[model samples]
Target: MKAEKNAVLTGAHFIDGDHAACEGAIAAGCKFVAGYPITPSTEVIERIALRFPLVGGVFIQMEDEIASSIAIQGAVWAGKKAMTVTSGPGFSLMMEHIGYAAITETPCVFINVQRSGPSTGLPTLPAQADMMQARWGSHGDYEVIAIVPNSPQECFDLTIRAFNLAEEYRVPVLVMMDECVGHMTEKVVIPEADQIDIVERKFTKKPPGEYKMFETNESMVPEMIKVGDGYRMHLTGLTHDERGYPAMSPKVQQKMLRRLVDKILLNEEKIRHIEEDEVEGADIVVISYGITSRVVLPAIKKAREDGLKVGHIRLLTVWPFPEAYIRDLAKRVSAFVVPELNLGQIVHEVERCAAGHAVTRLVPHAGGAVHEPVDIYDAIKGVLEHA
Candidate 1:
């Protein structure tokens, strides 16, 4: 659906990443948000609690993150564009619901402003440790979209992109923000309502008695029908048929889970987004995402100045994890230096995709703060010295 004109904040404003994400949701036509306030991410729903009402939207502070996560899915089925906000601990609490959304194919968004954590480890600090958890937190086999934003502007832009993808794929999309990006303030330029591209829910064209809730076309994305629209639907976490009925057979299980994943795997080319630079003759490429992407740029430049040809790939979409791209690039590069806020989350993915073609180096940090670019530069230098 096109964004409501009144909800569009079409101008420049200096705001924190969390607040900008709130406005981004508004511009993307989100009418309902349910969140339980948590450190470093509270400002997102705090802004929503105030601003949502002004734009004919609603924000509910649920009893806890579990309630907050599931509440948004209920809103989605009621034909509202809905989302929930949280941090690391809350993200852990919401894993079950993320699975619910995935199995039910509910169109909703989860904004996790990540903090250092095994369990409330550092509530006010930033961490990218949840990258693997975001990909595989929920139980069962399922694929979900996760987007990473490095700057405040990207926090705004990518949040809208998160919603559009959730709508387009009929799956929960994760806005994986860390504490640094969420709390950092910057100038965010929001465009006019008309200029924004929105992907509305693909509602079923069938009449009341003709629709099958889980039936999908070639896209593997089924058309949705809101509750109270005179269409009967059965939804469960169990393996079900296209009509949404439970079938306990192994074959039914295979079919349901396959589509749950294939819808994303088949469209990897469209969903994957990566930014690359200076790779034609580079000996090593540095891969990073979210806030770490910005932190690594100076190191890349420094290495280049020292006559080390280092390329960069700032991952925009982290989940359908740019496998083919990395595999192809590994054929040319001698090694990959991965520096992230975590010890070594995504570096493993790069290693796996490199397929023994290139050396993979991990420059790890144990959260709370960003990486020093010199550390990254040293890693690049060491890799080249060995090569």
Candidate 2:
């Protein structure tokens, strides 16, 4: 579908990642934003507050992050694409609502401009530490699609994709941004409206009496029905049946829970994304994402120059784990080097997929900043030497 004309900012502009993301949201037809501005992420809503109204959108800065988190769901149920922006401290506050969105199948987006620390470590610094939290921050068995952008251009491009995926799967999608990417300025070219492809919510064609809210077809994503559309609906966080009513039997729990996960895993082919280079015969494959991917580029070039056959896999979508690709690649590579802003989050995932078939080494950091190219270079060098 083409973008809504009023919402499309079809032009080139030099801007920061936060502002680029805001424009992407506008272009993707996201008309409502509810957020409590935190450092690094405040600029996203700052731009939205100014642009949303012009595009017939709504911008609400709620009293706190919890209010901001749940507010977007309300807008989504009312037939609007909605989102909330936040940082570490605020993201923790929003966990309960994230779970609520999952069980109730609310299609919404959340932008997390990650900062460093367990509790307010560095408001102005950068870190990719929230990766694990983004995957498992909410308690329960569910899946989320997360994408990381290394530049302002992708920041603009992928924010639109995030909303599309949310609507496609009826789950909360996360734009896992870092403070560096959020603040870094670069040229972002947004294309004309006709060039943009969008996926709108699939509203049910069934009449009021026939529309069962949680019923699904082949895609496992149930067609949604608006609350005031004269449809009889009941949505709950507890185990629910096809009619959306509370059902507590073990059989009901297994059916509902499995569908929630299987929808993503079984359909993983549609969602698998990774930028791989020279992995055909390379011994060491470096896996990284977000700001860390950017930093690792220089090191990759250096490795190539030294005649070390090093390949690169840059993760665009971090969730659902990209299990198939990693599992296959692990068999051929001598070792997999995993690095991130956290001490060791995604590395465990790499190890799990590799499953003792190959060596998986970690390059750890405690956040507040990114790694130096040399630090990553040395890690890659050591692994290849042992190989």
Candidate 3:
């Protein structure tokens, strides 16, 4: 019997990483982009600003990150797919609005071309250091969808997915890319415009007299009505009821809050995405994502060559954390090795999911550059031998 081809074929493209991300967003039907230029991420905005006008799109270089994020939300509320590109410091400034978007259920895309952190640790250097921050940086208990692309092609592909997911869920989506993938050149084949699947937000169909902005349904995502759509809707950062009016009651607030979190949490199966390898009979599993996962690939291969039963789990969806998959892997693996460009962010999640079934270890590295494959190989070998 002949082998069947996988439905999702993985391939790489040779193109400037930032340009690829920009081109991908354009191809994905993004009509509005608002951002403040920051290092590493500047290329993304630069390309978007140059090309947006050609595509009948609006690209604004706002006064600052806060205004940029606000403009993005405004564009989405106007019924257009909008995005903002930024880095660490700019992302810090956008946190409040990120929370606002969460509460308002405004669907927009945020591209964070990550650079060294704390406070501009290394602008040109790559870092997976923002993983935790991407998930928790914004205040509050809302769930946000963040996609980490390991390459330029993924930067493009996932940017499209981010927009699609944003519209489908009516929540803000993030394209989390690091300096290496953002700057590296790779060959990418972009599909024809008609070949791509575009998802638009579910607009309200009820008459103006019957519309309720925050009303929930089976999906928990309310039907959105744009400003001029003849529906009188009120949007607020404060906890609100179905009428979109501010609610002071504790029960209303709790119900609203739970719905906000539940919408994403309960739909984990649809939102969670991951890549797993060699786990049928593995004793060691290396968990990684983004550019850091690129380093992990070779290390896993070397460990296998050295006669160790090893495997890997790469997360394409960074936020919402793919806990179920991790927990399942934890049950079968002897140890979970997590490598990232930070002291210990994702490792905490891995440890939490692994529980007592497997030992979880962190191979931490800070910004200047990525962890060498040899270091990861050593960690994998050490864990396997030690275990």
Candidate 4:
């Protein structure tokens, strides 16, 4: 599907990543937004509140993060594309609903502009600490698609991608933007509506009497029906049968939960997006995402100038973790150096994927600031010197 004409801005604009993300959501046919303002992420909904009205959409500031999270799911079931924006604390509050969205197969976007913290740590600063939480915070054995943006332009581009993935997979999609990317201002060119591709919600054509909400085809993704559209739909976080009713049995639990996990795991190749540079023949690969990807570029450059073959891999979609690619690359590379704003999260995934074939080095940072290029360069050199 193509984007709506009126919803596409269709021009060049210099804007912050948060505002760019809002424009992307609108361009992607997101008609409803429910969120409470949170630092470094508030501008997304602030722009939505003003722009949604012009495009015949709705934006509501719910009482809190929990309300905001669940409200978008209601809008989604009512046949509207929906999203919510928040930072760390608010993101934590939304975990239960995230799991609900997973179990019920709700297609929605969550824009989490990550801040420093376990709890309200650094409201205005940047951190990539939520990398692990975005995938595993909700609990249980469900899967989600997570995309990270390193700049304002990518913030605009990937926000639209997030909604499309949500619609395509019938799972919650997270746009993991750190405070640096969320607030960074740059030129973003939004093409005409026709120039963009969109994935509309997959609604069932079966008659009301014949329809079952959780019935699936070969793809393992179930078709949806709009609420109040003459079709009966039942949705819950509990283990459900094909008809969407709680079955409360171990058999039903295995069947339903496994599908939720397998649909993503089975189709991992289709969902994974990683950018690799100079990795074909290199001794060390520096892996990073979001803001940290940009920060580590100079270090990678210096390592190369110093004659150490340092490859670079930027994870565009962090979740579903590109394990196969990393596993394959590990066989050729001697070590993988991972740097993050958090202490160490994604590096663990790298270690697992490397699987004893290669060494995994972490350049960890606490929340408040980004890593120095020297720190990353030293890690790269140290890895190579040891090898």
Candidate 5:
């Protein structure tokens, strides 16, 4: 399906990442949004509140993050694509419902415009600290797709991708943007409605009496029916069988959990998005994501100028971690240098995947700012000396 003509603001416009994300959601057929206004991310909902009504959509400023998170799920069951936006602190409040979304197979987007934090840290500053939290913050074992964007243009592009992935996988998809990207202004090209592809909801084709809410075949994703569609639906957070009713036994628990995790794990290659350059026989590969990906480019250029064999890999999709790809790359590279806004979050995933095949070094930062080019350069040179 294509975007609605009215929703696709078809032309080039100077916009910030927050506003671009709002336009992206609208372009992706998202008709309902429920979010609380939080720093760095508030502009997203603000634009949605203003623009949604014009597109026949609804934006509600919920009482809190908790309500906002679950409200989007309700909207999904009611037959509309939906989303919620927040920064780190509000993201923390939404974790439980995130788990609920996963277990119930609700397709929705969660935009976390990341800010510095373990608590209510610097709300206005950028941080990539939530990379780990987005995947592991919710309790229990479930999988989700997470994508990060470095620029306002990509902020628009990837948010549409996030919504598409959510509908395709029937999992909560996250658009992880940092404060710098969210607030930075850039020229964004909004293509025509026909140029934008949309993944419509997979509504069940079976008649009401023949439909089973959570039934699936080879795709590992079940067909969905809206709340008033004459189908009986019973979705719960507990372990369940093909039917969406609760089944508390261990066998049902194992089957339910495996399906939820395997659907993503099995289709990982299709979901993985990373950009690699000059990695062939390179001694050091710099791994980074989000704003840090943009920040580390100069360092990479400097390393190449200094006669060092260096390459770069920017993670466009952070969750699922691209474990197999990193494991393969580790076999050829001498070391991997990970630079993130957080002290050491994604670097651990690199180290684990490298698994002694190559040295994994972390150029850590404690948030509020990005790493200097010299810092990343020094790590690259240091890895060469040690390796």
Candidate 6:
């Protein structure tokens, strides 16, 4: 795609939040989008369908979420930057394919613009209820990356980062966007082409007969060869060896699965991302992410003004869950308070990290509306005065 002359200002003109995310995906070199229409996330597909044809990219509206996810995997195998966007219900339908992406080590992005749910609790309301689901939704013990963006700019920036991480790790990366960020518009500065850092899938320059599909060198990211590249590569959802052939033998399966998990799990330093504020001297640390972090910020400010030793930690990458950072903060702070749209998804992680050093509290609010700043402020005040 040729760079538009005034493309730097393109995001500025996209007033609709979803359209901004759609334009961001295109600007970030996404060539294929396959998804079913769902509330909140539907606009992403609609926008892509309209613009992709002009850029020589492909856009397919599948009959269902299952087919949409399957099509995305196929597009990725065809060596394009491909993605599927969905809400809670659609995401439920795509779980099996998500596991398929995991086992095949397919590099692709899945955008879940989350709406309320255990099972379609609220189709159009914002909720961070999917936090745990994003990590454990697919089934099995596979490690994956899930990022939460709090605003439209982050929805744009993190979507691009999600693609980069997927290609680098050869794993499915999920961008968790709540209805709040996915539907709200704000000024987003899209970087110029020369200023942007884009990572393409690493491809082998070796001749067709010489290439190995899953052979890993020092980087642990194997050189990807496309399906029709005359490489004779094989891919399957079953456990497979370096050649991409199914390895039914117990030992081969063990080796392949271990490597797949280790490739991301062992590289914790590279995958973990968070933002810390006033944490150094704090006695109570408030932990939050996604849209909940937006609400928590004002509470943190209020606590500070009230002369409470309160601080905040906002996670940029929610999965591969910033355990190390949380653990470190745990040793220093007197207590930890986690506020989310769900009852206790992330609070458990904070509790695990805090262990014996600090007390952990859950300030949860479900689907109907966001937790007000005062609710979080009271939680922090209570934890501090009582701990």
What's each prediction's TM-score? 0.99, 0.98, 0.95, 0.99, 0.99, 0.96
RMSD of 4: 0.8
Model 5 spans > 4 angstroms off: none
What TM-score, to 2 decimals, does candidate 1 have?
0.99
Collision count of model 2? 0
Ranking of predictions according to lDDT: 5, 4, 1, 2, 3, 6
Give the Å shift of residue 361 in candidate 1.
0.5
- Error (Å) of candidate 6 at residue 260 is 1.3
Off by over 4 Å in 4: none
TM-score of 4: 0.99
Candidate 3 residues 84-185, lDDT tens each? 999899988988988999999999988898888889789889887777777888888899999988988888788888988998888889888999999988
Model 1 segments beyond 4 Å from truth?
none
> What's the distance in Å from true for residue 293, model 3?
1.1
Model 1 per-residue lDDT at 10: 89
lDDT of 4 by residue, 214-251 (tens): 88988999988998998867788888899988899999
User: 276 in model 2: Cα distance from truth in Å?
Assistant: 1.3
lDDT of 5 by residue, 1-387 (tens): 899999989999999999999999999999999999999999999999999889999999999999999999999999999999999999999999999999999999999999999899999998999988999999999999999999999999999999999999999999999999999999999999999999999998999878888889999999999998778688888888887888989999999899999999999999999998898879999998999998889999998999999999989998877999999989998999999999899999999999999999999898898788899999998996877
Residue 299 CA error for candidate 1 (Å)? 0.8
Which pairs, if any, clash in model 4?
A: none
Model 5 compared with the native: what TM-score? 0.99
Q: In model 3, which runs have C-alpha deviations exceeding 4 angstroms?
A: 1-13
202-305 in candidate 2: lDDT tens per residue?
99888988878888888899999887888857878898999999999999989998998888788777887788888789888999999899899899899889
Residue 286, candidate 6: alpha-carbon lDDT: 90
